[model samples]
Target: MIEEIPSEPVVITHIIHETPSIRTFEFSRRFEAQAGQFCMVWVPGVDEIPMAFSAGNAITVQKVGEATGALFSLTEGDVIGIKGPLGNGFSPEGRVLAVAGGVGAAPLRPLVTYGQADTFILGARTAEELLYAGELAGKAEDLRIATDDGTRGHHGFVTALLEEADPASYDTICVCGPEMMMKAVLGILDAHGVADRGQFSLHRYMKCGVGICGSCCFDSSGLRVCRDGPVFTGDVLLRSSEFGRYSRDAAGRRIPF
Candidate 1:
């Protein structure tokens, strides 16, 4: 029989800086976790935040707040509470294309490890802010990088790169990035008649990683992002006005669009 997994604190055994602002945390787990899923990271007396798994074996976290800042300060053997590898993750079944922007590339790293014919498009404002270049370069069949300031490979938005990409060559696409970038990508896919063929990871402030908090809701078919997603399809996001606009925190405070 499968042993019941307990919800408890796990010790952070390693931390690796990926970029100036992004870091990856390694946690000791008794079992393997699915790629693209996240865990509720509880920093004692501070706060708990939902962070997605970047590398499958290591729980990677981007330093975005006070709680996460504290997490980055940790060294090996430091402990933190963790509840899950909860929520849905991407199903990498066939030929795929992965698009990520800034720290958004963290979660897609694990997906790259599973053998597949995949291409990755990563975007950032500058070369210094980019993460996982070496990792992605080795895993993807084709790797493309874009920067907004013309400091990198392609001097344009990632959507511009998407526009130039041969979408018909891939069987599936996965996107994770700024809401506007994903929306732009969706538009590009739609124009190519491939909108229904891709998946997107929606980033939002989530508390109580479980559904009780009601903090991560979006208007797509009455979908609750915390429960139904942090990931959804282009088709679902397109129908929702709130997908790119409104978001809330644990206290139900409206986060500015």
Candidate 2:
């Protein structure tokens, strides 16, 4: 079972507006989390949502639905329940390529901090959605940004920029994003014959992040997302048909990806 951290209500000390819909909330105290560890956040009467831990006990929240909406509605002094630093995290070294899509940059940011050196590629639907540009600049050896629209950087998916990059220069690649985006990244690496050098972070609906309810388990393999991962090696992901193909909802029903 995964352990929950803080063990008490945590107060929000500060907040940074990353985008109109995304915000990074800093807790009153540091959580000592790792590169890819996540926290189960409980918001009073609202729902509990899992979020990747950012720097200094912070968690970036993107207002995507009711749960996030409720979380975002809180004021600076508001308190929330936090449970985690759960699951495995990245241990990247040497020349690294850190890839992020949309709010997926939240988790990768900590990974970059841990690595201390990396080339970061951040993407979003528009330039406005691109996050942590300056923060990443201080940590990344090189930083690239992309948007689907012509709003910023490359006028296409970040993967397009990645293709133009000399992937052979990096010892490893760490990626987190929408399933489709991750799939595309995997494909590009495969085509370039560097598939083995990638690590992918995946998301699925969760009820109990401690691996008790078995809600985050994958089909066929019995691998629990809350326990076995949220992050997986390129080899494990490549071999799993479900990697980019399917997921379960809150009801544990198979849903095509």
Pick by lDDT: which candidate is best? 2
**Candidate 2: 10-residue stretch with minimal lDDT:** 1-10
- Backbone clash pairs for candidate 1 read none
Q: Give the deviation of candidate 1 from the true structure as CA RMSD.
A: 2.7
What TM-score should be assigned to candidate 1? Answer: 0.91
The superposed Cα distance between candidate 1 and the true structure at residue 53, in angstroms, equals 0.8
Number of the top TM-score candidate = 2
Q: Per-residue lDDT tens digits of candidate 1, residues 76-157?
A: 8988877777778776666788888987887788777775437889999898787788777877778999999988789988
User: Ten-residue segment with the worst summed lDDT in candidate 1?
Assistant: 1-10
- RMSD in order of candidates: 2.7, 1.7
lDDT per residue as tens, model 2, 1-257: 34444545899988899988799999986877778788889889987778889775799989989989898888899999888778877667678888999889988998677665468899999888888877877777789988999798889998888887877677888888889999999988888888888878788899877788898887667788888888887777777868788998888788997
The number of residue pairs in model 1 that clash at the backbone is 0
lDDT of 1: 0.76
Candidate 2 lDDT (Cα, 0 to 1): 0.83
